[model samples]
Target: MVSTALQPVTLSEFMQLHNIEESPAWELLNGQVLQKPMPTFYHSLLQKYLVRAIDNANSVYEAFPELRCILSQNSVVPDITIIHHSRIPLGNQPIQGAPDWIIEILSIDQSVTKLISKIQACLAEGTQLGWLIDIQEEVIMVFVPNQPLLLARADMALTVLDEIALQLTPNQVFGWLKR
Candidate 1:
């Protein structure tokens, strides 16, 4: 959705005004404020379960939900961000660069095009993996650098983070809905 309240501001300016932990409803794209729809219970559940699942993999990565990642000029709040241990910040500051893996959970009011654009931006900026999870469609769109986008269904296993030897099928992920 178009935001009328947004004034063009750099990432530093945006950060200066908003605190990531407190401003969960906003994101910065290309240095503009964008409002996000409040997440549904299903979205929350999926994010929680996926974070736990990824953490259980015990790789050198750790998952953080609703984390604000600061790119050069843009900032994004991915539903779940898995960052390599080396890149983890020493303090409580927001992530300084693109995450190793980024996952976006679709919401009814969100625009797919905007979401894809965010993913593509991250991929172009050196993100190793990105996933657009559409629980409504029971499908996921995978994005990787210099590779064809992969469309996956529930039963098919999709590579989550190849660098960490992690692969998860949509069914395995969506199955957590039974909780």
Candidate 2:
């Protein structure tokens, strides 16, 4: 469901209402609370596979699932975030910075234009790469500087960080939900 509010609030005020068991996912984008749907089974599985594969390839990546990215006065919890291991926050709060990689799994409620805008925001904030995975179309949209590539099938493997030797077949990822 979309937010019913006509006015925006401060990011600090937004964080104060944080609860892990909340119904929908909420983020402070431009200091306004943005709510999106919770993950379905397929979405959740892909998230896990990405994390596990990354962890297996290199133990040094600081990967967090649903970890909030704290900005100047707002917070955004990307679906999955991959940062350098040295930058992991030790406390109860999320860190500020465009994570090296931010992955967003699409939901039916979000518009394509809106998602692109969000990816652009990440790029402006210093994110090296942003991925928008479309489950329905079975394609992955990758945003890199000066280029945007769409991978329609798992056979077309994807690579975000070059240092890590990880490969994911789209079919393998989607197949996990069948069982």
Candidate 3:
């Protein structure tokens, strides 16, 4: 993530700037603009597999990639956003609140601290689950409401929304890259 030194802009102004055709996605963190890094091969693959796994798990929730979520004064485009079917925003408008689940795959050279801060921001705004997948380390940092940070590796089963009937592990997630 590259932070811009420009003066802070309101969310509405940021939205206008973000809608330019063919422009790279931008995030508003604490009223500052930050350019998201382009995803690497592994980052892209992990996002695809995770979305597929979550979407296939059940109909109660759906996972979307690169969806912009407007949370209060901050707006973020999480790598993957999972929303309960009933809570899905009704129109062409971007999601107005934090998603039920937010997943971010760490890109090469991206700041892990910033990513974790993003996840924590979402968690503070009602997100039930958050994950930061570290492809190189083959581990996942899990975030849940009111709980300490948890790390999952190898065959450790990952936690998911209670309504979703899928079981996953870091090993299984990384295995997708083998194909």
Which candidate comes out best when scored by lDDT? Answer: 3
**TM-score of every candidate relative to the true structure:** 0.91, 0.85, 0.93
Candidate 3 lDDT over 1-179, as tens digits, reads: 77774788787777777342223588887778888888888888888888998888866999998888999888999999999888787886678899999999998888998999899899989999999999889999999999999999999999988999989999999999899
**Residues 12-92, model 1: lDDT tens digits:** 777776444454557778666787677899999999888988898899899999887888888888999999999988998
Q: Candidate 2, TM-score vs. the true structure?
A: 0.85
By TM-score, the best candidate is 3
Model 3 residue pairs with clashes: none
lDDT of 2: 0.74
1-179 per-residue lDDT for model 2 (tens digits): 25534688786678777462265667766645677677787778888977887778875675678877876655677788988888788787677777788888887777677666667777778888888888898878888867756665768777668777777766766676676
Per-residue lDDT value at 77 in model 2: 75
lDDT of 3: 0.87
Flag regions of model 3 displaced more than 4 Å: 18-23
Residue 115, candidate 1: Cα error in Å is 0.9
Worst 10 residues of 3 by lDDT: 15-24
